[model samples]
Target: MEKRYASIVFRHLTADRLAIRYPGLRSVPFVLATPMHGRMVITAANALAAAEGVIQGMVVADAKVCLPKLVVMNEPPGLAQRLLRALGLWCIRYTPVVAVDPPDGLLLDISGCAHLWGGERSYLKEIVTRLRGKGYDTRMAIAGTIGTAWAVARFGKASPIIANGTEVEALRPLPPAALRLDPDTADRLIRLGLRSVGSFMDMPPAVLRRRFGGGLPARLRQALGQEAEYIAPLRPAPPYDERLPCLDPIRTAAGIELAIGRLLDTLCARLAGEGKGLRKAVLRCHRVDGKTVQVTINTSRPSASVPHLLRLFQLQLPRIEPALGIELFVLEAPTVEDTAPVQEALWAGNPGLEDTALAELLDRLKSRSGTRAIRRYLPAEHHWPERSIKEATTIAERPATAWTTDKPRPARLLATPEPVEVTAPIPDYPPMLFRYKGEVHLIAKADGPERIEREWWMESGEHRDYYCVEDQHGKRYWLFRSGHYREGEPQHWFLHGFFA
Candidate 1:
């Protein structure tokens, strides 16, 4: 695709901001001054002040002299860049690639974005109109290159949207300063009777470099599309993303669902073709009021199934509020995984953990409850009960080692064991009865004084002598005694786990 870029110049960024905050300043002449070289100098002058012969860079005392009634306010440090960054972030709904052009400008990579708003004319108008509504005086231009767009937005007066391949013609009439040259270089060019870019358009690179330094030639080449100029966007664009522009703003839940279905269909098709599936997907709804509403969905396993993923998103649709209406929908898969091919089933029945249906069910359960609510555990290569199993990263993940069934482990194990009061006849024998949570449980049947030593490499800790004991009411309990039992010392007993 042919690349296109846009530049927005805030002619009176600070002054306009001040006017917006203090509405009365809009009607009066004012200037924002900051201390420079031990003296207060005018950093910005409102349009009214400019009309009265007061301008930026003029000494505050001189500016006051130009208009005795001029209101002077101290300029907040870094206000210009701060304001530009905020405005650039707001412009993200227009294009994902928005770069802050410091002081008073922003750059947008609107190559394929303009078509969403009808065309370049409508796109530029929509942006300019919105900014104007917010009380900013902005001038914007779109061209085939960033250099050309920036030059035209600041200097050219003909038209805002420069046609592709006509960058040379559009830039020729603009002044040499439009090429973003240093003031000294521009002044030297003007002194040499080269007032416009056209005057030096045909000059050799070596000659221009010798006279004006290398910056001028590079800028010239960039403007003419000879050199690549990439914008450092405020946020990096996602690799797997799809955009759906609605000609009419979407308002109803049905409309939103339909949009999600369409987006999923498109995204899933691409993923399926590439043998990949999205693990996490986010849907961003850009409202007409310049606000964004988003809903995110995650999968238990990588999935390319449109209906299943759509169903997962359906659970999150109530979170989206289409305040005025949604102008665009962007589906971004920030995390995707390669999906392995699965064999067709000979008969219709559950395929256990490897089943896609089972994965979908888990995804739905997680979407309704939470990511943490659903978990899968696999046996780890460890002897300690706490370290025997590890949480599976994915539902399809295989265990490195087989589960040890030689030992009869409890169905449920507490993360940390609770202390229990036990009465045992001897150190090697199981407890006769245990008081747990202030309740006495008489041991009806008992087995084991299984000794589990702590893994020395992990940490230094006392070995546990575990016992599987049953209460009088037939409830089973797993109890453990800490350390070697001493003749005089009190033994530490803990109610570790329960078995079903």
Candidate 2:
């Protein structure tokens, strides 16, 4: 394959007036700031300030003095990151392999994709035009290597340059600063009588290496296209996906199922060829009018077997109503795992068992009752009965041990704390009689004055004296009395948990 690459550069990106348009701050001398001591410190200067002779690193106060019209907006790291990520995702429309060059830039390996967009120049124009249409000031360059592309995009002539083997000649007229060298290095290169890339290229390799270390020569080679560069294309995450654009929209359930079956066969074949399996799948049915209906399924294990996957899909197919006829069908797997060998049971029986059936049942329940509604209880690191249990997403397999006999825990736990009327002999004694849930229950049997200290570091902290009391009906309740006897306030008792 031929070597081809493109670097999309958004220059003075932090200072771009278009970007400053956010929050309606335009023509205002603004600087991007990184947080320091609860305040923002200027890092990059806007063009307006540069025209006014104000430079970066000037304190917000001093910058204001220089340009009274200065509009200093606190740096938004998150907004900048989101913009970069959006750009990166947009690049996927051109090539699946797009790497983010943060703070504002993208590196795209458009090797075999340029032809699809009608060649490199047209593709470059399309990208720049589209971005400009979206209110972004973008400049792009296409070259053999990343270094050369970066150099040209940052320092080449006003227009986007597409150089093939003439990268050195193409780059020679540009200034040495185009190489993205450190400020110190660029100053030294200038001191050494090298102003442009041409001056640096004229120097002997050995002399450049001796003076600038190993990096200078590598950069030189990269710019000259003498050294090869490889791009790790971001492959579309696996467990193959396929989409079918239907000419005649299908509305009936049977028609939808048939279309899904065809897509599943293609997806399964691709997965089998790649030696991978799908752990989860999503089917998006785009309607003719505009809406989208999505149905998804997750499996206990990775399985690309067509029959098994189709069966799972079949169970979910009825839920998707093609209201206005489905125009497109897209199958995608968001989660995938390796199809590892299953260890055969010592008894040599089929893998289908009660646990497997139960896992599927739970999955079905989760699908109908909402994934968040069904959960498993896990023990938390706390001695307080109410704080000891935590709810987590139910996993396919249960832990080896469900109950722990190592420590005594309440058999029942309340959903929420209930207030209890208590009268105890002392702060250390268990409550004698407690009115709970609108009923006065005399403590027929009781144990414990378990002292659980408040987690003082936590915002919601409470100091309580806990007790386990068995009522006349044989039901047990875990109650806690807040505050010590010496504390002036009357003790507030609460029933925190229960026992079977």
Candidate 3:
């Protein structure tokens, strides 16, 4: 099969992105500026600014004189390159062989994949439509080679899609800059009456090399398809992806169910063979109408159970639209983990290291009421009571450090302790009575003055002397006296938690 490539260029990528974020800048004259040579200079300008005679490399003060009401803002660091990289990653959904074209462009090896979107025309339209929807000003071109695609995207007519074996014709009328030549070289060509690519491309190799540098001829041959050029495309992230192509397009709900089942089975088998499991997955259906429908599922633990995953998918299957008919099913587990094999015991079966029932219950609860409905906490090795525990991702993970046995902890912990007025002898005695929240409570029994020092590494604060005391009603309370007691100062008391 013949190779086909597509290139996308964002003409004013940074300025356009800024306009999208700040919509008012789209119509108003605005330039992204940075300090250069002790003067604020224009790094990039929006379409509105450019139309008002403002351009890059112009000093901001001079630019303001050109458009008196111009708005100048600092350009985000590496703005163009970052946007290009992000867009390159997004293009992976179309083709896996996508490469970054530096500051403002991307090269895609569409190859045989274009037919899936109904042809190169529809494929190009889809890409452009999505980018325009994202509020970017894009110019795109598709052709037989990357060089041809790159040249046409920047220099050819708007939205050009040239056919295979026509690169020479497509590149002939373009300026010398279209061959990726520097300004000095292109100016030299223009001075010699060699304005277009065709005018100087046919020149003798030695003459061209002597007149310009060796780079100009090499780039010209690359664009003309005379020399083979290889692109080190960005390899798509590895996915535990399983795909199923139907022999005939199926439109019925039952057929869709069966396709999902087959994909789940295949995916589960593969995951099991690899000794891995999925935590998050997406089911993508490629409908015959050139549209895609997707359903996502998340598990509380790394799971390979086909039935459990199918149940989760069934809950979201009604949301899929089978417009004409579905031709392909793709199940991708974007998140996976190493799952140890279960060793069955002689008397009973084992569900790996943790209880599977609890995991299943959590998954079901999360699927119904959302992930926040269920949560488990693990003990952290922090001396501060409030920072001693953290949310646990899975039940199988054990705490690295044991809970502190030196001090008796409360059953219920409060985010911040409430202030309590206590009547006690200063310095070394427990509180005899305390007024908490509007009620006075008499201490029937009490145990301890456990001294806990403040964690100076995190923050500087007062040390605490904690005491577990029972009220007249037998309800136990955890109280703390803050700071060291001075001879003439009264220490502040606080209610930190409750003991069971």
Choose the strongest candidate by TM-score: 1
Estimate every model's Cα lDDT from 0 to 1. Answer: 0.92, 0.73, 0.84
TM-score of 1: 0.89
Q: Which regions in candidate 1 have their CA more than 4 angstroms from the true location? A: 33-42, 58-62, 72-79, 92-96, 112-119, 191-193, 273-275, 341-350, 426-429, 442-445, 471-475
- Residue 447 local lDDT, model 2: 80
Give the Cα error of residue 83 in candidate 2, in Å: 3.4
Candidate 3 residues 156-177, lDDT tens each? Answer: 9744898877787888899888
Flag the better candidate by TM-score, 1 or 3. 1
What is the TM-score of each predicted model, taking all chains together? Answer: 0.89, 0.58, 0.62
The backbone clash count of each candidate, in order, is 0, 0, 0
Task: Please give the lDDT score for candidate 3.
Answer: 0.84
lDDT of 2: 0.73
